[model samples]
Target: MRFSVFTLFPELLRPFTQEALLGRAAARGLLAFDLIDLREYAGNRWRKVDDAPYGGGAGMVIRVDVAAAALESLEAVPDEVILLTPAGQRFDQKMAEELAQQNHLALLCGRYEGFDARVETLVTREVSLGDFVMMGGEAAAACLLEAVARLRPGVIGDEQSWRADSYSSGLLDYPEYTRPAEWRAQAVPEVLQGGNHAAIERWRRDRALERTLARRPDLLATAGLTPQDSAALLSAGLSAEQLAQVGAPPPPRKSRKKTPAPAVPES
Candidate 1:
C-alpha cells in the first residue's frame, strides 16, 4: 500500500517509518511511504503555514488555503485521506484491517492548534488514536500507518502471527512469557512446557477469556463465542448480567470498574 503523509514535521516522522516494521515492509516491496512536507507548500518567504486563530485562541491554526493547495498539488492523490484529530472517530484494529485493503491512503497530520475546521472538507474522514491530546498529529499518523501496513500480505512474514493479535478475535491477547522460564518467582505455566499442543491451545484460549472478562468484558458479547467458550466463561465466573452485555454497546472507556480475573486451568 502507498501512504502519502502531509505533515509540517517530516523529520519527526521520517526516521520512524524508515526504521521499524514499516522499513522492513518497504524493503520487501510490500509497502510504500511518501512524506509530503506541508512546509514545502507554504506560500511565504518564511514558509509559514499557520497563523493566530480567528476570533482569538491560544495557538496558531493551520491555514486551510495552504492545506487545500497542498492537497491539490499531490502527484498521486489517494481516494481516502484520513485527517488525524482528537475529535475524529476512534481508530482500532477493525479500522486498520479495513484500511489495509485500500491500495493507497493519504494521512494528513495537524500541528500547532490544529487544522482549520474548514479543512475537514478536504479529506475522506478523521481518526483519533484515543482520548487524549498530543503535541501534534505526526505520531498518530505513524501509528495508523504501522497498524494498516503490517496487515498487508507479506508484511509480517508469518500470517499466523497477526491473526493472534489483540482484538483480532474481539478480545485482548493472552499473556506471553519468554526466555527465563522462571522469573521473579513466577514460573512458566506447565501446560506450555509439557509439549502437549492441545493443552497449550486450551490454556491460551482460557487465558484470553479470563483476561478479557476481567479487563474488557464489553468485548465478550461479540467475541464470536462458541458453546465451549460460553461453558468455559460461565465456569470462570461470567454472570447473567455480564452475559447480557453481549451485543449491547460496549461501556464507555475508563468508566467500568475492573472485575477479578476468574481462574482457568493452570496445569
Candidate 2:
C-alpha cells in the first residue's frame, strides 16, 4: 500500500516512517510512503500556509486555498483522503482494517488551530485518534499509518500475531508469559505449561473472556459469541443472568403453568 502524508512538518513524520516495523515494511517493498510538504504549496513568498481566523479566533487556521492546492498537486490522487482533527469520527481497529485494503491513502495533517472549514470538503474521511486534542495532526497521522500499515500483507511477519491483538477479536488479549516460568514467586499458569494444545487454547480463550468482561464488558455486546464461548464464560463462573446483561441471549425457560383444577366437577 502507498501512503501520502501532507503535513507542514514533514521532518516530524519522516523519522517514524523510516524506523521500526514501518521501515522494514518499506525496505521489503510491502509499503511505501510519500511525504508532501504542505508549506511548499503556500502561494505567498513567505510560504505562509496559515493565517488569523476570519472572525478573529485565538490561533491561526490553515488556509483552505493552500491546502486545496497541495491536494491538487499530487501526481496521482489517492484512493482515500483523510483529514486528522479532533472533530473527526473516532478511528478504530475496524477502520484500520478497512483502510488496509485500500490501494492508496492520503493523510492531511493540520497545524495551529486546525484546517479551514472548507478544506474538509475535499477529503473522503476525517479521523481522530480519540477524544483528546493534540498539538498537531502529525502524531495522529503516524498512529493511523502504523495501524493500517501493519495490517497489509507481508508488513507484519506473522499474520496470526495481529489476529490475536486486543480488539481484533472484540476481546482483550489473553495474558502472555515469557521465560523464567517462576519469577518473583509468581509461577506461570499450569495450563500454559502443561503442553496440552486443546487445554492451552481453552485457557487462553477463557482468560480473554474474563479480562474483557472485567475491563471492557461493552465489547461483549458485539463480540460474536458462539455456544462454546458462552459455555466457557459460564464455566468461568459467569451466571446466565450476568451473561444476558452483556447481550448474551439467555437460555429458553419452559413454562410450568398449572392446569385448571376440576372446574367441570363444580359445575
TM-scores of the models, in the given order? 0.88, 0.91
Provide the lDDT at 254 for model 2: 49
lDDT of 1 by residue, 187-253 (tens): 9998888889998887898899889989988788778876556656776897656655574333233
Query: Candidate 1: lDDT over CA atoms?
Result: 0.86
Candidate 1: 10-residue stretch with minimal lDDT: 246-255
Q: After aligning candidate 1 to the native by TM-score, how far in Å is the CA of 77 from where it should be?
A: 2.6
Local accuracy of candidate 2 as per-residue lDDT tens digits, 44-155? 8999999899878598999999989998988898999999999999999999999999989999999899999998899999999999999999999999999999998888
Candidate 2 local distance difference test against the native: 0.90
Question: Judged by TM-score, which candidate is best?
Answer: 2
Which lDDT value does model 1 have at 97?
90
